[model samples]
Structure formats: structure tokens, C-alpha cells
Target chain A: MCRTGPSPDPPEGGETTSTDAAFTALLEDSADELYESAPCGYLSTLMDGTIAKINTTLLTWLGRSREEVVGRMRFTDLLTVGGKIYHDTHFAPLLSMQGSVSGIALDIKKAEGGRLPVLLSSVTKNDSTGRPQLIRTTVFDASDRRAYERELLRERQVAEAARTQAEEDRERLQEALAVLQQSLLPAALPPVPGMEAASHYHTASPDRLGGDFYDLFPLDGKRWAFFLGDVCGKGPQAAAVTSLTRYTLRAAALHDPDPVAALTTLNTVLHERYAAGDPRYCTAIFGVLEQAGDTVKVELASGGHPPALVMRQDGSAEYLPTPGGLLVGILPSAPFTATTTELAAGDTLLLYTDGLTEARIGEERELFGDVALRDFAADLTHTAPHEVIEAMTGLLNSFGDGLDDDTALLALGVPTDRPDTGSDSPT
Target chain B: MDIVSRNNVTVTGPQDAPVLLLAHGFGCDQNMWRLVAPALAENYRVIQFDYVGSGRSDLSAWDATRYATLDGYAQDVVEICEALDLREVSFVGHSVSSMVGVLAAAATPDRITSLIMIGPSPCYVDSPGYRGGFSAEDIDELLESLDSNYLGWSATMAPVIMGNPDRPELGEELTNSFCATDPAIARVFARATFLSDSRDDLKTVNVPTLVLECSQDVIAPREVGAYVHDVIPGSRLVTLDATGHCPQLSAPEATLAALTEFIGNQS
Candidate 1:
């Protein structure tokens, strides 16, 4: 164990004499010497901020002599103009109330032109009676820390600007997609003289373009041409196929007016246009409507598509099946099955894309197949064409997130014998 | 919105006495008048309020576009006067709020009858023949200083700075809430305070105005105070024997004496 008291006299030796001299030198380094040359600056001021005492370290940092600073200057006189305002407005008031303030950053002016960044702390020194007498302060150099903080602040500003720019670009792109989507469908369907007609289209996502399409336009004096179809795939490629199919059917119907002839012309056009490395196809129902007296005759042909449904005025609904039809745009010579139906007063015919039957429902992911849709139609057998389309639109909305594909619906019916109203006029 | 709660307004002293509307400057809130308000309340009814972005006011009402200029702050003063239904009031403002007083008085001439400015400067940056004691570069350096000090304002200090009026005990817990404000709001208020030039507006002041200046101040020098007195047609100037920019805190007795004497003469 080390001795705490005075050690016994050692024998005279060279090593012992050198150790004694080193100890004497360390003991001679007085408290006053340590204070004047300390690493950080130290200062003492009167309660009103008159500089009463300052160490050599702080005097040297200010680039001033002890005589010039000690009695003549105040603490605020050593700060920059901005630091003076901040001191008067914030620091001095806070110290007066809090008794001590720590980790406050400020800038002090030197005798020369430059400034020195510093971190300062001060505490009030009270007399024996517990009344405040003076203030003791300590300061440290913070040049490196301030520089690093400035770098971080700059980087954050740059990142914020980039994020705002990205948001603006995304909004502009979505607007352009919406305008292009509107051009792929008709604005309104023309009104048939002795019939009622309605249509609805649903899009699954705004980011991608939908492939389903439908339109109805007058073909001649007493006949109208209509078609509904869904192209394979989605986006711009499927949109191009849909556009080609619509125009081909409309032009072929005006020339011949046969439902099978219009589908044959569309199949030829789609097969030739997309026959290279990438193949495209579609499922379509093309039909023609002819008004004869108070009744209308409907003839439609299907190309690998679902059959059309006919709801009769006798409160019954059935499918007009067009079986054995081959997929359009696949084979050079494809067969399309033609089916005929008559719509009396209060009877409606509906055509829809497969997006309705293939929709996934509930947590079980079950398909709302063709059977449920037929039963749904049977309840509305005596309704008008617009009423049937409105009910189907409501059913589509009820699916919510379960329906993930684009859908199109088209309905046509002969008007009842009641007095004609101008509400159905094509204005 | 209830204007009384939105501005954290406090009314004190005799209700039948003449009104004294006190407005604080840029750095602090209405608490800047803490040292001198009690003495003034003995003679006059004192009305104190904080701007939307300062003190315990509703910070949610602060809009970046509306608070971008000095006119927005002037609108706040006008709204407070209208809310209280005050008439023939003496408007006392400090620092940048001195110029804000000029605007509010010009907007509602009948309501605000007189103006008293402490450490007021119509402009901060120097112009052709005028010396406002600062340059454009100096203002930029001040903004940097504000940014550096904001780094020291930690999360633990947020609750103390954002006072809770619901619990009166929490208000007592705040000892250092004088100059502590949200840094983002402080930046906007700082830019609006320092970058404005209201020298042209000073000529339009037709009220009984008093300009108070400190004997030795680094922020607003004696020359700027003299310029304000010269521009106004009939204005009285008083030089307080003080050292800093804020005379209310440094030399409260002299500030209150000069204020009481001028207000007494006005009546």
C-alpha cells in the first residue's frame, strides 16, 4: 500500500534526486498560473455586465490586452452587432430570470475583421446574504461544430426541393392520361327513334388505360349499329386494338348491315395489324337494330364472347346463345355464330364484357359467375333499358375493391305504348 | 374565431380609465412589458396581446402567405382594437412594432389616438443619405445567428415554451418563455421585421407621437431616432439614459416616467 504521510529520507542516489526535483517543479505550478493559461476562456463580470476580471486565454482570443478590456469594456461590447441584439433581447433577460444559462451559441468580435463562433455558459454568483453580486462565464470554440451543422441544414433543403418537384410531375402525368382515356370512348349515344338505349363503363385504375369499349351510332334511315368488346391485355397496346375494332365494325355495318359481316371485317383488320412478333386479340359482340312498326328486331354475332341476355315482357329472362364461335384475330378464317331476337314493348336486351362475371368477391375470392347475373336480371324483366343499366351500375359499385378489371354495359329496348315523352330526346 | 383567445389577450387595471394598448417587438412576446406594465396599470388600463406566431397565442391561425409582410402584423393590431371596441387609445409599441403602430394608427385613426415608440427605427438597412446603423449583409448574418441558436432549442424545452393555459400551474413552470418561440415562425417574423422600410409611412402619421431612444444602443442608433422625429410633422423625442436597445427592461423607471408624463400632457 502507498503511504499517505511524509515518506522517510531516501539514500542519496542519482534516480532519487531527479524524482525529487520533478515533484518540486509540479508543486510550484500555482493555481493562478493554471487559471490564466487554461484551455478555454474564462470571464467574470459585475451584475450590470461591466467586465471586472478576465483571464489571459479570453483576452488573447479577443486579440486585446488585459489593460484595454478589464475595466473599460462590458461583455456585450465584445459581441458582434447581431450578437448584441440577441444578447439584449434573449440572453440577458433569460440569465436575469433563470440564474444560469447553458449551451448557448453566440459569435464574438475580435480586434481584427473576422468573427469567432463560440458556445458560452454563465451563472450568477451571489453574496453571503443570498443576493446576486456578479456573473461567472465560460466559453469554448465551436468553429468545427457550426460548420458541420450548416452542411446538414443545406442537404435537408435540397431534399425538400426535390420531393416537391416529383409531386408536381406525377400530377401532370395523371391529367394527360385522363384526357387520352376520354378520347377512346363516345361522348353520348344517339337516340333510336322507336327505342330506348343506355350504356355505362367502369375503369379499375387511373394509372393504366382500360381496354373495354362500346358505342351506338345510326347506320341508315331506320337501322342502328352497336358493338361492345374487351381487348386482350391493357395499356396503350390494348387501346390501339380497341380503336381499330370499333372503326372496322362501324364502317362494315354501313356497307353491308349484316352482324356476321361486321365481325368478319374487324377480325381481318386486327389479325393483319398485330401479326408480327406480338399477337393481339379481342372478344366482341356486334349487332344491328332495325325498327319495324312498334317492335324492334335485334341480330347479333359473337366472336368467342359471352351470349347476350333477353328479358321479355312476360317477366322472364333467357340467354340467346351463340355457341361454337372462334376467338377473333387468331385464325385466318374464323366462324362467328349469329343469333336473332325480337324486343316487344317493355322488353330489354343487354350485352356486357366478361369483367362482370369474372369479378372476385368476398374473402373467399369466389367469382360472381353468369348464374348470379341471370338471376339478377330476372327481377328487372319488365323495366326499361335505362333502369336496367342504372341497376347494373349500382351492382358494379357494390363490388368495391373486389372488382379489379374494366367493364362495359350496353342495353337496348323498344318503347312502351304510352304517350312518348321528350325526356328521351337526343338533345 | 374568438379574437380574445386567438391572441391571448389580457386586460388589467381599472376598466373606466383611459386605455393603453401595449405591443411587444420581434424577439419576444407581450411579456416584454413585464417590468413596466404593473406601474403603467396603476394609472391606465393596460391591454396586452401576442401576435399569432408569438407567446401563447393560437399558432394554428398562422398562415405563411398572410404573415409574409409587415401589413399582416398591422392587421392583427387593427383586429384586436376592433374586437375590444376600444376608442381613443394610446398605442405603445417596441422595436419593429413601433412601425406597426404607425400602420395601425393610419388604418383606424379614430380608435388609436396617440403613438409612443421605444427604440424605433423606420428602416434597418441604410439608404442613400440615411444611416439606419445596419447593411443588407448584416441582416443576413443575423439570420444565420438565429439558425445556429435554433439548434440548441431541444425537444425537452418544447412543452415549456408552448405554454398550457388549461393548467395554470404549467404557466407558473415557465421561467424562460420570454424569447423562446417556434423556430420556423421566428424566421418568418424576423424577415418581416428587419427587411421592411417604413420611412415613407412615417410622414403620414398625424397622431400625437412620442419617439423614445436609448443613449447608447447598437440596434437602433440615435441618428435613426432623430430621422423619425424630423419626418413626422409634430413629434416629441425623448432620449432615455440607458445602455441597451430595450429601455423597459434596462431602465424601467425612466421609461415609465417619460410615458406617464407624455400621456398626462395629451389629456
Candidate 2:
């Protein structure tokens, strides 16, 4: 009875049916198990965000029983407060409009007092009548992903903080350099009685501090010492040379009260300080102004500096030529020249560094030469000290980015009218 | 920088009609009004724009000092109105933009005719004897959440991070997503929007106001809407059946009905 010799292919239909029935049962059981223990958690919520059904995997991840969540808690209640707010504001509205929203990263509050990072994808399932019946959501455990992102964010914050600190340090260094540079210049030009005085120093580059300095301090016996000078190069080294030059000139002027002696003292100090290989040099003009009744007497000395301009009351400008001067701090005993000029009524004596004449102009990048300067000064013959400085500043502004060198301008004008009723101190 | 291009202003609808400026909230851009704006365009001259640092706005215009507070965003709104020469407007603001509109209207009352706040919270941090809804710790957690999400986004948004301005279509392609803000700007905006205390500005709203409160809105609750209504003089409060914070997207028809009724009644 047990099927001998192939047994007519073992009643093919009957055997096949038996195997198929067994396979069907196994497949059904496998599908059920697959859904209940899937890698991700699944949930179904009502249109109003009420939890209608949930799988075993979700309940296990939440550490809650089916009885605790279903019909008792809303889907949003399982989220942290901030996540809940974000859900209500952005997620829900997006889902309703687009019919689905996916890849939303939110945190779910555990049954205990903790949070679970999860990446949620949700879709609204509508009934046969097209009314949205429920929201079907799948949550993936994103703890590892969140940790990686947190690490990345921490690194980014660290880099950002370090970058900010570096920027602040650079800013502090720049500020210190600026204060040092300011110390090398006069806070305010000293007022010379019966003569109006104005000076301006323009920096060429903001990155590195310039080493151009100017000061007008009073000397004994109704005389005043004024100097405009430019040190070689820029930055800290040039700044040091400028500081030394300013202090030595003032001390030398106090002792001698002579323009040529003040220049010689500055030259001696620079040559002595930096004589060993790294020599420091400068171009300077030292002068003294003393009131001679209605006119002012000026004694000018030049040490490789540009010629000074004397603008007269008749709108004619001429160079107060002081030639045959050597560069300061070069040779031990450098030769120099002195020229004396008087500022009569409505006359302005302008002493400036070569930075004004060396300024680049136009597309050809040509120099704004001495001839242009003379012409500009001639046009402002009757201008007062402040007005002349203002016009010159306007001209500098018109050059735009073309003016690349530091400029120092010092002007002493004999006022056309009587002096103001204010005190002698500069405002 | 032209202010119009800086804020990515996009003007449409009837040219001669009264202005209806729709300002988007914190997390999204002007695209949030894609559905409702087209409907409102039938009657009113619809105006929409992306705030600087969001959408297609000029990123170079983002100054940390200028955009440090909500006042800066409010100033942008005023400037946009000025750029378009829009004298009178019915401002429809959703979520954080509601309060942004509040400040702008308070400052430039002559420009704004009616204020329609979908969901506004005058202050988000809770204090003694006040119910602003969230705590400081909760806000901190929100910031952390934003941080995590932004980190995730940066991986895919590499082109934007590299500052390749030539490929603007890359950003345009991701317009449908809700969280498409630049990470740095979003952090600053999150801090500014959530940490603001604008209770003092409520009484300064001189325009006719419409408060649209939704049911079960966790971001801006019913009490917050009621507080806004009570403080703002001659403000009308309507509790919508829409269940979330953004009724403009979820329940646009209802929002349109209320808006048209109010705007039509005003004329």
C-alpha cells in the first residue's frame, strides 16, 4: 500500500495540493512574523493624530504595552514638547497639503523620562470617499545617525568658535597697532597766535600701520617748532623709528631752538640707533614760525624732503626751494639746506611729504606731480587754513583708490581778517 | 544691494488692487503660500517675498548684526513695502511671521491696513504669572533638534556650503521640503524668533486685526491667541476648526473665507 515503483507519478495533483497547503500556511506565518518584528516601527493614527493601531515593534521601542498607547494616547503625546510643537506647526500642515511627508527627523519621548531619536516617514490614507481617514507612519531608529550628526555639529561649532577667536585676536592686534600709531602723531596741532594752523595725516593702507608723523609744538622766545616727516617702509620697525624721531626733535628743539639743529639731532639719533646693518632713514622738513608784527617769519630746513609751497595773497604759488639736502640717517655728517619764508597777510605756507605728489591718477596710473600741486594751491590763494585742508582732502577723496601712499600736510596761514576771539588752544 | 533683489521680492496679482502681503514663517519661505496666495490673487494684489538668507534671497546681504533680532526682519518687511511703493496693505502672516507682521505694523501703521495673524505667540519663554507656553530648557532642546536636523541636511546640500552661486537650481529643486533654510541663518533665526518678548508691542497695533486661532495648536495655543486678541484694541478673534498651527496650508478654504469676509467688510 505504500507506493511501489514510482506509483504513477504519486498522484500528481494530490501530492501537489498537500505541499501547497503546507507552504501557504508557512508563508502566512512568515508574513505575520515579518511585520511584527520588522527593523522599523510602524503606527497608524487617526486624522486628528489619535493613535488607532500600532505594531509590536513600535510598542517595544517605546517600552509601552499595546493597551497603554492604543485608544489612550495620541501620536503627538509620544513626542517631546518641542517635537510636538514642530509636528503641529510644520509636519501636519505639510502632510495634509501634499498627502504625505517623509524623512522628518523628530525625537520621541520614551515611556520613561528620556528621548529616542527617530527619523519618521508618514502618509495619510484616505477612505473610499477620499476623506483622509488615518495617518500611517513608519519610524526608524536614528540614534546612530543622530550621534554622528551631533559629532559633526560639535566639530563645526568648535571650528566656528576657533575661527571667531582668531578673528578677534587679529582685531585686537590691529587695535594695538592703531593705538601705537596714534601715539606717534600729535593729538591736536598747537595753536600759533595770530596764525591759523591745520594739519592732516592720511594713512595709505589699513592692514599695516604707516610711519608718517607730524607735530607743531611751541618753543621758547615766542617761537614754534613744526615738523613733517616720513620714515622708511611701514609697520612696527618704522613705527619705532618714527617715535624716536618725534621725541628727539622735541628735545633738540628745546635745547637749541634752531630748525637745522633739530633736524641734525633727529638724524644723529636714527643713525646711532640703527647703524649696525639695518639702517633706518627718513625724509623730513623742520621749521619754526614766529610772529613778526602782522606777518609770520618761517625758518625752513629740508633733509631730503620735498619743497614747500608758498601760496601768496595774489593767487600765485611758488616752491620755497630748499635743495642740496641729504637723506637723514645715511652718512654720519649729512649735509642739509635751510630756506626762510614769510607768511604775509592772506599767505599760506604749506609743507607736505612726497606722498601727495607721488599719488597715482587716471587709468594710465600717472603720478600726481608737483606741477599739479602748485596749480591746486594757486587756486586756493585766499582760502583759510581749514578751508585749504578741506579742499585738499576733497582732492584726495576724488583720487578714490588711486592714492596709495601716506600723505602728511601742514599749513600755516596768516589770517586775512583778525584772529577769532577764542583762546589760543586748538579745538 | 538692491533691497528688492536682496529679499527676493516677487510681486503678482492685480497691479491697481490693494496689497495683500503674505509673509512666510520661520521654517519655510514664500513658497508656503503657493496654494492660498493664488486664490487671494483674484481680488487683492498679492505680494510675497523670501526673507534674506532664505529661499532665493541674496545671501551676501545677510549681516549678523542687522539680522540679530526680530526688529531686523520687521525692518525688511517695511523696506519691501517701501520698495514696491505699497501705501496700504492687508498683511497675512503665519507662525513666526505673524509676530513679525505685528512689529512691522506697529512701526509703520500707515502702510498696513489690516493684520491677519494665523498663529502668533507674543513671547515664547514662560515667566512668573505668565503663560508663554515653553520653558527655557524646552527652547534649548528645540535648538538642539534644529542643530541635528541641519547637520543631516548639510550632507546633501554640499553645493550651497561650497558657496557655488552658479548652481542656484540646486536650491530651487528642494523647494517642496519644509526645512530648506541655510543652517547658520536658521540657527540665528530660531534664537531670534523663539526668544523674543513682544508683549509690549501688542497694545501698539493700531490697525484692524484678525486673530485666526486653530484647535490643538501646540506652537501657538488658544490662550496665546486670546491674549493677543485681548491686548490688541478692536481685534476680532475667530477659532478655526483646523487642528494645527498652519491653517493656511491645512485649511486654506476656511482661511480664505475669513480673510475675504474681513477684507471685503473693511472696504
Candidate 3:
């Protein structure tokens, strides 16, 4: 402390040499002490990051003596392993290129295995010849900043864990819904004598349960009843309607087995079940295959469903039109129309939901309409029931994210040759 | 998919000459070959392109499902060749792109005639029988470094890095300042590139190949280069006197010499 100017008027204002001498002595004494006791830690290092000079405050922060750090350790050695790697790869290169970097957050390893979070700012000093000489650094204790960052990281981790749990729950729900959906449909189609039957149901999304369903079951004496239908919309509610529709169709067919009568019964059941706030509806086709003499007669009835396609052995396809049918469960008495078509040795009847015809064509909004379906079925005239189903399923797959709705398909074809009944004959 | 713009394909040099396709490695784009490509373009038809989500290429085309593995990058190379209708290509790949080249050759064997891998590593993380120059813990540290480094640079340079839509030189400048890419995309690519194991693919490379290993290279060490040379049947190994991972940037003449000699021998 220079007490040379403490008096009111510097009583010895004329004694200039004495005051100048005191000021000079004060500067010389305080420079080193001021640097040593600065608020922030100060250090100087060689160009290669070897520490050359360090102050008491930094040494105290690192809990190391001057002998241990100066010249014995690189500036990066004070950092933890990960921070050291970052220093080597990014920090050093950036310093060399840009000549300085500031506010770099890193964790410095203390002498006794504790960590000191710090923000470092460094500038490269060069000699008079403009060659790089040493680096001067100022490090600020960032313990509070580090704590804030860690709290932020912890909150982020908590949110991330919650998001992951939500995603897992959604996947589980999707799986459960898929299993439940599979249970609602028939496991396998019942084998009919002298006939081949194949069916496939394609759901647009693997996550949501679709409402498309189909089943082929035996009625009383020489007749087999089959129905393919799709409920409006999707998900669990639609799945409920699907289950109800499937069981009601089975029960109604067990009583009547006539195509129009069974559909009429289904329409009545659904209309009564959901006549309140939200009206439930479905487009369906009910068919029965029965043996007459030599050929099989398939009686099909439609309720706002696409007409069935009959492909003959001669490579010709035609839609057996069942006109004037309304959607099931819409009106109390939605018209259900029935039509009869004969299935000879080489005739195959194909029934499908609207997903196929309504699939988008490439990026266009235009649907894959009757023209495309006609072309697709015209080529599959000689195909068997299973082969036709396989080919149609492949076509649906070719849409490639364009088919945005669920589709159900059913194909019934008579055999080319009846099996000879010799020893086990029941005719 | 417009493969041309997706990979930012640039075709120059004599059209009828044998094609030299240059593919860059991680932390860089086609500009990594800036010094070396001009000389090669004088003699050969030079083709350069950036990977999707890299410099000047369409970031919109970066599909995680498509680029989840190196095969996706290999598919990019094959598609580039098909789009250009280039036959008899001498594929020049740097760092991780070496394995990508091998995959491309295996995919379209007739299009690519030879392979040049500079500072190549089949695997970065060490395995049971392999000395891949890094451990899983080291890779984790590297990943952390990447995260922190991106955080350090993105805050200051994001606008300059992303705003120069038409001028690609800005992107090159960003790369020079800080190896810049979209941070999220870069993280995905770093994991994909570092965690991959393509040691088995080296054996399937039926074409003539050359491995250019730099002395004192830290990213791909000498032993990893030798392993790549040993597995690739009849492939030539040339150790450049240059140092560091990017010889084309640090020692262009040495890198160019090795590349020209190899291409001449193949032709």
C-alpha cells in the first residue's frame, strides 16, 4: 500500500521524486501478487499444450501443488478422459486454426479423484516474428453452471424415458389388438368336397386392427356358406362390430343358409344393435356353394358390396352384377339382392372388399378402378382358387403404401376332376 | 428418386476415358478430393458426389431406414454409376467409404473395374481376433466428443452453415472451419460408420484393388490397413510418406501420385 498520497493535498506536492519512487515501488511489488490472487485461475502453456506457468488459485482449485502441474503436465492432462479426447481432436485444432477459443465447458480432474467443472477461454500468443509461442488461458469455476446442465440432462432423460415407455406401451397395444383381430377371423377354411377355396385378409396398418373378415363354414346337407365383409372404419370399435357381424352371419346361416335371407338377418341384427347415436354399417357378400347334378351352383347375395368376378377357363372375366343392394344396417330394410351362378369344372368365382378397387394408382388420386381389376382378373382365368388368391394378394402388395384400407378376399373354384369313389363310396 | 441430385453428382474430364469415381469419408464431402481430383480429371473422366445428408446434397433424401447401414451408401454409388452409365470405373474411396466401395463392387461387379481405398479400415472397434485400433469405450468417448463438438460449433455457425443454399463454397468454408453437417444426421452417420464391421466384405471384392495407407495415421492405423490388404485378394498396398487421416488435404501430391499410379496400372 502506497500511503504517499493519503494526505488531503499531498503535503509534499513539490517533492516529486519521492512520490514517483513510491509509486514505482508499489507497481513492482503488486504485479505478481495481483496475478496470484486473481478471482479466476490463470495459466500459460507451450504451443503443444504443456503447462509453463500457473497461479496459486488454479493450483488450489485442482488441489495440486505448483511442482506437479507446471512443466510436468499438459493442460489437457488436467481434463477427464473424454474431455481430453475432445481437447485433442477439436479444441487444439480449433485453437491452431482460429488462434483462440472461448467459453469451452469441460470437467477438470482434481488431484483426489474429484472433478471441477470449468469454462476455459484461451488465446494464442506469438513472438515478434509472428511464430506461435505460448497460450494464455483463463479458467472460470463452472460448478453452478455444471449443476444446471446436469439438472437439464436429468430432466431430458426423464422425459426420454417416459417417451420410450409410451412407445413400448403403444407397441404392446398394437400386438394385443393384432392377436385379438386374428382370433376373430376363421383359422382355416373348411374343405369342401370337389372344390378348392382360398381367402386372404390384408390390413392396411399393422398397428391398428382392421374390420375386414371372412369365413367358410358348412351348412346342413350338401351346402357350404361363406361370407366376406368389411365394417366401416377400423380399430377396437370396428373390431367389435366385425365380431358381432361374423357370429350373427354364422348363426343366421345355420337357420336359413339362403344368401338373401342370411344377409337380411345380419342387416336386422346390426341395425338393432347400433340404432342409437352412432350407426354401424358394413358392406358384405354372402354366398352358398351347393352340389346339384354334375356342376356346383353358387348363390351370392350382396349388400352394397362389389359384384363378384367369375373367370372362366377360356380366359374371360365378367362381373356377376347384384344390383340395387344397400349397405347393411343403414336402413332397417336395406335391400339384399341374391344372384345364382354355376361353377363348372373350370369356373372360379372371386369376391373382394373395396380396398382393392379403391387403392390409389402411384402418386395420383385416381383409384385402381374396374378397368384395372378387369385386366387383372382377365389374366387369371386358368388360375386355381389358391393361385388366384396368391396372385391377387401380390397385386395388392404391388400398390406399395398406396392401399390405405383393409381388404378381404375369397375365391371358390370347382375341381377339374371329381375323385373316383370306389371302396369308400357313400353315394 | 433423382439419384443424380440426391448424391450431388458432378461429372467432368474426358467423357470417353475410364471413369474415376471419388467417394469421401466421414466428416467430409466430395470437396475432400478438391486438390487430388483436378489432376486425375486431366487424364480420366472424374466423377465426384456427396453422400446424402452431406455437403450440397439433398438432406431431404436422408431416410433413416435407407441409410441405416453401409449398404445404403453402396447403393448410392451403384445408382450413381447406373445413372451416368459409366462402365469400367476406378472407384476411389477414403476412410469409411473404402468398405462402401467394396460393397458397391460386389453389388455391380461389371460397372466398377478397380478399387482404391485411402486410409481404409474394415472395422474401427476391436473384435475378438481383430486389432481395430479402438475399443468400445473409446468409441463411446468419440461419440461424446462428437456431441460436445457439434454443440460447440452449431451454436455459432449454424446460420452460415445452413443459409447458403445456392453457393456451395459456403458449405466448403463451413467444413474448413468446423467439419460441418447436420448434427443429428452426423450423429447417425458417425455411429453407422464407426460401429460397422466389414472385414468379411474384403474377401468378396473380386476386382483389382489398391490400399493407400498413410504413415502415422491415427484414425486408420497401419495394422488395420494391412488387414484390409491381406483380406482383399491380390490387392496392392502402398504406404504413403504423408501423415494424418486426410492425405488429400494435407499431402495432396503424395495422395495423387499413389492414385495416378494405381489407375494407370489398372488401365
* Docking band of candidate 3: incorrect
Q: How does chain A of candidate 1 score by TM-score against the true chain A?
A: 0.76
The RMSD of every model to the true structure, in order and in angstroms, is 6.1, 7.7, 11.1
* Candidate 2 lDDT over residue span B1-267, tens digit each: 487777778788888888899998877667778768888888789989888877657777887877779899999999998888787899988888888898898878889888989888899888987798999888877777666655224545633532346876565445235456667787788888889998888878888889988887888899999999999989999888877677777678898898888888777
Candidate 3 residues B182-237, lDDT tens each? Answer: 65677677777889999888889889999998786667889999898899889999
**Candidate 3 TM-score versus the reference:** 0.56
Local accuracy of candidate 2 as per-residue lDDT tens digits, A3-52: 23544444467778677557657766686687788899989998777899
Screening candidate 1 with a backbone cut-off below 3 angstroms (N, C-alpha, C), the clashing residue pairs are none
Using Cα atoms with residue i matched to residue i, what is each candidate's TM-score against the true structure? 0.77, 0.74, 0.56
lDDT sort, best first: 1, 2, 3
Top-down TM-score ranking: 1, 2, 3
Q: List candidate 1 stretches off by more than 4 Å.
A: A1-35, A45-49, A88-100, A123-135, A182-270, A278-365, A368-400, A403-427, B1-22, B36-50, B55-61, B79-90, B151-184, B252-267
How many backbone clashes are present in model 1? Answer: 0
The DockQ value obtained for model 3 is 0.11
B1-267: candidate 1 lDDT, tens digit per residue: 888878889998898899999998887778788889999999889999999878778777888777778888999999999999999999999989899999999999989999999999999888899899888877777777777776334447655455565676855555556666777787888888888999999989999999999988778899999999999888999999887778887678899999999999999
Here the TM-score of candidate 1's chain B is 0.95
Please report how far candidate 3 places residue A139 from its true position, in Å. 6.6
**Which of candidates 1 and 2 is the stronger one according to TM-score?**
1
**How many clashes in each structure?**
0, 0, 0
